[model samples]
Target: MTFPLIKHVRAFVVRGGGADYHDQGSGHWIDDHIATPMSRYPEYRQSRQSFGINVLGTLVVEIEAADGTVGFAVTTGGEPAAYIVEKHLARFLEGASVTDYEKIWDQMYFSTQFYGRKGLVVNALSGVDLALWDLLGKLRKEPVYQLLGGKVREELQFYATSSRPDLSKKLGFIGGKMPLHHGPAEGEEGLKKNIAELAEMRERVGDDFWLMLDCWMSLDLNYATRLAHEAHKHGLKWIEEALSPDDYWGYRDLKKNAPKGMLVTTGEHEATRWGFRMLLEMDCCDIIQPDVGWCGGITELIKISALADARGVMVIPHGSSVYSYHFVITRHNSPFAEFLMMAPDADKVVPMFNPLLLDEPVPVNGRLKLDDKPGFGVQLNPACKLHRPYTH
Candidate 1:
């Protein structure tokens, strides 16, 4: 089981939607009036880009083995992350074994802890960690899923996240999660509108299909509680990321106060196992959604998922396309996956990270059958321009 030493590490930044899926152009459903912490401001409320959600662009990390095999990963961090990867993180992997991901990850995290326990620094570290795993898979000539212990199920089932769940239902997803367009700042009328939208969609999709709301950390405790109760009337399966990720106490209260049948979910913005320990140990939410690209890559996610699995909690990763697909298929706790509707109007299915990844998989009729391709079964899109902002 000899593995080649890592030879070169490179970091690149690319703009306009890849790993930075939020950097979409005008008229994309993702950028259209999605509720957020910045929604209180009248001007920025209309579009997320106005609040700089997509400002980071994308960070791509490539780890090349001495054998000339290159494994790469993409995450949202842009030039800042690229700088971290090239100037800081690359030292851990340049001459390390491709199989020493654990040691490399430990060094990368501890060396940067003075500045980054989470967020941008963790994102850069995560990109490198994922690239290491990709390199390991390539070196072993196995798909990442098999490297993770093989699939527990025959295929992956998914729910759609978009502005229109009705269209997703027609597309055959098991559930549809719509963005909550108006937050507490929008007031009572906005509250009514939010429930009305849910009710309307519930009617269109019938009572059986699972419908949920993604608040995107825009609601207060009182507002989230109220929304939960009202949305429960419409058979809302869950209310997601209703409060700020730091509000563990608030999440605990919201989880308790939410309607008996409705579930409280959060953690898309959370990072690392320690952060998730606060969520789980505090009884914060029913399900913890960690984005593979953001929540410390596969290495940290393995720890995070194990924590959740031990407590009988489900770990449904956020919309991370193949990075999530490879991990999700191997875990029993992750029964299904999330397919973010990348289509501008949510009218059709498209690759989640379009134009950034080649051979990226998408669900057909709400299900995905993963192939045995090495690494994550995809490659950086050759046509997409990658900017090498920094070099180690």
Candidate 2:
């Protein structure tokens, strides 16, 4: 019997009705509508501009088998990511075997070696890899996790992620994350302001809840140490993206100073097992945040998680909560997945098959729940209004 081979791959750039996904007020970037009083440097002002105002791009891979089974995968990003999907990835995947996902991934990785590894190349590879996994699951009549190894956990516990105080209260989430703000100013004043905000967030969630703070690469070692100290006092669980990736020594130092029970987490921007291996070897972080969509898709994430597991560390897949939801439920060691209350109108922007739930396995008492649906269990909403098509 002949195995199924992928017939075609297509990419799309869909513009959704919202601000750039990253520009939302976790305090990293200012809303574009607000004009700065000072004549700031061009680079500084541009960084503050909002990119989430519209859907920059979404890449979907449709793989058709000889038997007519169809599988889909999607990855979203800003201009660089979108450009790779549109200009390069699909051509490489054309006529490839969906069954040999690893081989195909290797092919893409080597092909793009000249462009250097990771970043946009791996991100684009991530989309294709996910679509391939989705295709494989459909072909085998099993969920992607089962295909990877098997279920480690039947259900997953999730932390509610939001920047808005009222939304966090309404969601009844037991765990919440605050957006990363720039580290304290030159004086104690900035440090004082940060501590006050953390205290306020702690009060909002009460004593029983879990809380994390994202620094969004906004702090240096000195500032990170100070904030970590205060955050510990507030009972914060972890400090994420506290410093730039280059600050390995800073991370080691920050880790040493962090409160006893508190953990240091980062890696959303780091790529592949190589990036993570360094973080692990250096003892830089207690928890690793790998995006299944970004870190070479399911294939590399499984590898990265195993690396973390061997080191007695934890794996928490970043955004694309819908994808991570299914991925996490199947994994045994993944601690918690992030549920973004602040994500762009998830229900409206996510495909129909991937509808956001308001009930159990999601926002239950204080935790988000998982479903037993087949494959990833999410179907693209056939009713989704924006469906643009691109062919290679």
Candidate 3:
């Protein structure tokens, strides 16, 4: 099928559009503690807060073809990303053929190397690339996964990343991962407390359920190793982003020395294939977790996953709602997905990107199955007030 030309690229910033997966106001242990990453430090521990601003903001992108077919995606870097999308990135996609996304992605990546190798620029690039894929899928009357290849699994099993593992188990999720509250700065006493909570949760969930820790880039190699050593007896499945993302050497050490059978996963903050190559080549971690919205969108993720697939490493894109669902369903190595339980109290499950994207799918029985809809099977919520933060 000959698809129409890519006619326009546009982006908007919407406020009040995110989920508090951390359950900040729930008064739960970690939820009630640590407002910012800095709070983990001993000096700032007492100054912790309950919430921050981004919970209500996002950037949404849309790519329109000549025939008026539109594909869109929503991401966290909405305001800043809009600047990249309009001031620069739009030039590469507008007037290009819809099928020329790979070429467009390469051009966008290389052309912006001076100022956009990673971070917000790549995030903007990712939104645009995803919109292009959505456009191509719409033109072919197929979902993005079908366009990628085809489904590699019958259904996507999910593990919950929330405070309430018991609730997650009751909801039929395969496993539950909790955010670690303390780090090395808290000393040995803090490490003991971390283990104590994990042990309590393990007992609550029983022996068969999988338990994991999301350290959230808040530990040193020694702290992560010690935490892993203690968490091992609690049946921890893996430890995620325990150290700073730049610590490739630390990651290599943690993975090499982690408790036997414990998996190490990072890259939720890492972007692009080149960035991922650092992790893969150095043998940094056991699994690679890329958020397609941040890791150069769907385009860079495919390349990252291809590299990981070749190396026998897993490529589970972080819990990014529809953006990730399309990719995970098609890859063989991404056996399970991370579902961010957005329920404020961690008492109920809801759509991850509510008030921004319509027709968003939620998992059933710890498994997610995509519907047979064209493009991503989702649309911008008409009720979502979109404001263009920049003029192009």
Candidate 4:
């Protein structure tokens, strides 16, 4: 049965409790925090904080039809994107057809043309697009992946990504990532220190389990090579975001120097299929890590996955496994979803859709299992009371 065209599109700006949520460390793209309580909460003190902290805002788009069928979506990121959705995109989207997502995306992109593409505008668009897709899936009574096409695999695998090796091992994750730290002394010493840390983590996690490191865009080719070489001795499987995104040639060089069987994955900050195309064409990375929320939502992610798959590249999405759960379940090529280990506070504030046990590693044997629930399979916690709503 064909669904009716959308009758109304309403956008709500929801503020949750937290401090300044935007000030993520330099070079990290897409701040996924709820911004609220700058005044009410003492944690909002920016003086004590170096990064943007707080639940900025959640842009929830609800699409309704004549038959009373409704769909909902929520965008991550902080206040800036939320403002765009509430003040800008919502009016333009009202009464628009839900099925015409491409048209809607194009119109929104053009409307914000003067502002340029990427960054906050695209981030906002990502959220709205996700919500629309969720609504569509609900309308059809199918999971978002099935609506996209069909499942690629019966289950999706996940990597236990964290900086803390002890916690990861205690949590029962076979594969874990070490958080990227700055070079110990800022130059060569720091680089040596980083290699040493990875070597230590390797000793901790043992040789059989998968071990990786996120450089967090803090290394040059020379330093990365040094670290990768040391990492290989301890059986480090992959190194993520080792070089800055602008260092394409450097990555090519690093890839050449990197030990065989060691994979390089990136694209958490990269936008759209075009950005990924450049990465693939350049042979910049072996694995692709696209955040479904930031890398143009599920709509664009599916396309990006296809692009990666064609090249035999693995697609492992970054952040909030809850949002990515359905997509991972459906997409065959996406091998795993990253579970952030340093996000206990964030998770406590915005809990997972289906919280994983500390004992059972996600993907018992390299296969992820998704809860059979509708609309991203997530429900907001009632305990975390909303502070205020943004109205245009």
TM-score of each: 0.99, 0.83, 0.94, 0.81
Per-residue lDDT tens digits for candidate 2, residues 167-200, read 5555555577776543443247656866787788
Task: Please give, for residues 45-140, the per-residue lDDT of candidate 3 as tens digits.
Answer: 532343343443577788889998898877767677888889888999888998887899999999899997887788788888888888888899
Worst 10 residues of 4 by lDDT: 352-361
Give Cα distance to truth, residue 9, candidate 1, Å.
0.5
Evaluate residue 379 in candidate 1 and report its C-alpha lDDT on the 0 to 100 scale. Answer: 91
TM-score of the candidate numbered 4?
0.81
Q: How many residue pairs clash in all the candidates, one count each?
A: 0, 16, 2, 20
- CA lDDT scores, all candidates in order: 0.93, 0.65, 0.83, 0.64
lDDT for 273 in candidate 3 is 90
**Cα lDDT of model 4 by residue, 1-392, tens digit:** 68777666555545542112232343232232111122124343222132343335455555666677766655555556766777777766667777888888877777886993665677778878887887777777777767766667776655666456545555555577776554422556656666787778777767787888876565668878888887788888898887667677887788888999888877777778888888888898998887776777777887898998899988888764555767776666776666654344221112222221111223443345665555565544444343324555
Ranking by TM-score: 1, 3, 2, 4
Q: After superposition, how far is residue 391 of candidate 4 from its true place, in Å?
A: 3.5
lDDT of 1 at 278: 98
Candidate 3 similarity to native, TM-score: 0.94
